[model samples]
Target chain A: AQSVTQLDSHVSVSEGTPVLLRCNYSSSYSPSLFWYVQHPNKGLQLLLKYTSAATLVKGINGFEAEFKKSETSFHLTKPSAHMSDAAEYFCVVSDRNGNEKLTFGTGTRLTIIP
Target chain B: GAGVSQTPSNKVTEKGKYVELRCDPISGHTALYWYRQSLGQGPEFLIYFQGTGAADDSGLPNDRFFAVRPEGSVSTLKIQRTERGDSAVYLCASSLMVGGRDEQFFGPGTRLTVL
Candidate 1:
């Protein structure tokens, strides 16, 4: 079974400070990892994805994640946090095989302090 | 141009009632999916459709949950004998194609409240 675990349920960071949201995944095969963000009353938006290509994947809104195979981690990070970055983040995993169903982590709510 | 869209942004129903949620995928998207998200939890997969056929429905919690994607464009999820536990947000997503790397675009989701 492929699954993802988000280390923090909530993360608070001041504006202009660095941000880190940790995630760990478990999969039998080489899995596809993704980070998604959801704002209040909005849909889930794709942040970044790792598909066995480069370990470091950059996404929209100045977000990025690194896939670490040895550590089974794909942590999302940003150099600086903005008030607009406050949202719920989810770490997702899917089988590399054609099955596109995603297994999502509980989620981490990020609060950007202004 | 438009992302996935779901109908009935909010629905209130009583127990033992039947409810149907609709989803319209992006134009030309070949794959659609349904997921349920409870408060304080991530979305849980319910089913997947490729074209007009259901490729996988294993994630459905019970037989009371059923979905159809006829004509390969619009989809509907039907639930029978709704329970209070079934109250949650139902999300729909679509992808250009079914692949490991394909990104699934999500809808705003339909919030179902069972009384």
Candidate 2:
């Protein structure tokens, strides 16, 4: 079985400060990991994905995540947080063996304070 | 539409009633998926279809749920004898192919409320 665990249920950060959302995964095979952000009343938008080619993957709106095998972690980070970045984020994992079913983490609600 | 589309953004139904939710995948997309999300939770996989066949349905919670894609372009999720526990945001996504590396494009989702 494959699953993902998002360490924090909620995270708060002041505007312009750095942000981090932690996630970990357990899969029988090498996994494809992705981070997605969903604004209020909006569909989820892809932030980034790690397909095994690169451990450090960059995404839109200045977001990035690193895949670490030893740690079994794929944590998302941003150098600075903006008010618009406040949203719900999901960490998803899928095995490279073509399972095609993505297992999603519980989710992390991000709040940016002005 | 250029992206995955779902109908009836909001639905309210009474317990014991039947409900049907629809999804339209992107043009030429052969892989379609359905997921359910409750409040404060991430989307949970329910079922997946490749072309006209259901490739995987292991994630469906119970037999009360059923889905179909007759033509491989549009799909519908059907619920029988719905209960309050069935209330959730039903999300639909589609990808160009069925693979681990392919990205799934999501729809806005249908929020279902059971009373």
Candidate 3:
């Protein structure tokens, strides 16, 4: 069984400040992790993915996440926050052995203050 | 060139009625998926299709839910005897045939309201 847990349901950050959205996971097998962003009334967009390559992964729009196997975490981070970055973020995990089913976290809602 | 598209952005129906939602995947994408998302929760997997066959339907809640991808490009999800609990956003996603590394592209999703 594989599951993901997002520590924060909502996070607020001021513009130009650093942003952090924490996520943790439990997987029996080697897992593939992904971060997806969803704006209001829009579809989910892939931000980044980790497939047992580098521990640190960079994504679109200045977002990045570090895969820590020891901690069972893959927390998303950004050096600076922008207004457009306010959205819902989901942490997903899947099996590495060709399992296409993605187990998604409850999601973290990000709010950016001007 | 285009991304995944799902038909009927919104659907409202009375309980016990049947409904069908459709999805058109991106060109050349061989893997399609269906999920249901309730408010304040992440999407729950319903089914997955590889090419024209359903690779996995274990996530489906019950026999009332069925899906078909006759030609491997377009797919349909049919739900029978709808209940108020069935109200949720139905999402469709597609990915290239790259096994575990495929990054899924999602559609806007259909908002179903069961009355």
Instruction: Assess each model's interface with DockQ, reporting 2 decimals per model.
Output: 0.71, 0.63, 0.69
Each model's total of backbone clashes: 0, 0, 0
Q: Give the per-residue lDDT of model 1 (tens digit) for B1-115.
A: 5889999999999999999999999999999999999999999999999999999999999999999988999999999999999999999999989964578999999999999
DockQ of 2: 0.63
> What is the lDDT, from 0 to 100, of the residue A9 in candidate 2?
98
lDDT of 1 at A94: 93
State the lDDT of candidate 3 residue by residue for B1-115, as single tens digits. Answer: 5999999999999999999999999999999999999999999999999999999899999999999999999999999999999999999999997375778999999999999
Q: Look at candidate 2 and give me any clashing residue pairs.
A: none
State the interface C-alpha RMSD of candidate 1. 1.8
The local distance difference test score of each candidate is: 0.95, 0.93, 0.94
lDDT of 2 by residue, A10-77 (tens): 99999999999999999999888999999999998889998878899999999999999999999999
- Candidate 2 runs further than 4 Å off: A97-99
Model 3 spans > 4 angstroms off:
A97-99
Model 1's DockQ? 0.71
Worst 10 residues of 3 chain B by lDDT: B95-104
**What tens digits encode model 2's per-residue C-alpha lDDT throughout B14-39?**
99999999999999989999999999
**C-alpha positional error of residue B32 in candidate 1 after TM-score superposition, expressed in Å:** 0.3
By DockQ thresholds, what CAPRI class is model 3? medium
